[model samples]
Target: MTGPEHLSGTDRVAEVIKDIDADIIINIQGDEPMIDPAIVNQLIDTFEDGYVEMATVASTVIDNFDYVNPNSVKVMIDGNGFASAFRRETKDFEIGGYYRHVGMYGYRKEILLQFTKLDQTKNEATFNLEQLRAWTMEFQ
Candidate 1:
């Protein structure tokens, strides 16, 4: 069983994994069972770099999305292939910079533990995106 105090799935994962021995914790949403195993394997491979403490999957969105809609969260990846932001709102609805943010996450064990204990950020509460807390806290 997990604690009721868990505000997010990641929090629950942290609770379940605290005493377990593992190098990586893949936090995939219960609803996302269809996530591609190949992509997950690739993401896990990125951890071999040692500097990557956390990572999330993202894919190019071919369909036009309503940027104002909270459901279509976009991942801002810089030219160098690093995520700079995750947001539901953007003024640049015309041009580009819209990569669909996949919910799957890979977190190092220690980082996951530290993440669960931190307080939520304003942007996180506003957008209901817990990853915002990680971004704002300088987790990079």
Candidate 2:
């Protein structure tokens, strides 16, 4: 029942839940049907911190193929285990490693609504990652 006007999965989810009463919302991308439930639980638990407005999962990357694959998004984690950046591919001279970004997203209801209302950011368009849009807005 999703409309064609929605540009991203988050937008469609926002529309569907607009009338529902909920504090937290979880978004799982179509390509990630097989993702582990434990990860989803972990995402939900992140809301225990009032400071965490949004959260996503990331797993360690062990294989070289996934690291080089453009379809498998990579996440650079800061010292606090929060993602610093997301990218499809690594730079030639990049020194450190990155984790495989899980496709699921957890958002507070208010943040989800606000996020869908904003237009896409340039970094999001260039990287093809909705998370980038959220990240850019977090700082701005």
Candidate 3:
């Protein structure tokens, strides 16, 4: 077998999934070593329609008034459960009811490839979010 080539995390994942025939691909963060298996199952189970091109896990944000912390990424989901935006501050909703994005993602194989080809956006560079590059390209 060939040795692992040096690539960015997104590139590595995209390459691995390029030939997958699965209906859904789960993208979990490598840093989250202790992530619950139940959460993984939950994300997989959410693909009821088979049309969910992308999805992510989130939990109720319980942090008190400290929305400025860059470590916490706030998210707003539409009524259809699609993510509208992500940011460090509580932009659209009240801080108490915000949901913190869990960093795990689910996508179709085709979407994953498309994501890998997109260039990083200005906002993404500003926030240092690689995922934002994919998001900005409307891949998910």
Per-residue lDDT tens digits of candidate 3, residues 1-140? Answer: 22275234666777877776786889887766777899999988887767676678887744655466778787767787777777776654465556777878887777777776766689877876666776677654
Give the CA lDDT, 0 to 100, for residue 63 in model 2: 67
Candidate 3 lDDT for residue 85: 77
TM-scores for the candidates: 0.90, 0.92, 0.78
Give lDDT per model, in order. Answer: 0.83, 0.85, 0.72
What are the RMSD figures for all models against the true structure?
1.7, 1.7, 3.3
Pairs with backbone N, CA or C atoms under 3 Å apart (clashes), candidate 1:
none
Ranking of all candidate structures by their lDDT, best first: 2, 1, 3
Supply the TM-score for candidate 1: 0.90
RMSD (CA, Å), candidate 2 to true, equals: 1.7
lDDT (Cα, tens digit) per residue for candidate 2, span 92-126: 66535688888899889888999999999998888
Q: How does residue 35 of candidate 2 score in lDDT?
A: 82
The segments of candidate 1 whose C-alpha lies over 4 angstroms from its true place after superposition are: 66-68, 93-95
| Top candidate when judged by lDDT against the true structure | 2
User: TM-score rank, highest first?
Assistant: 2, 1, 3
**lDDT value for model 1:** 0.83
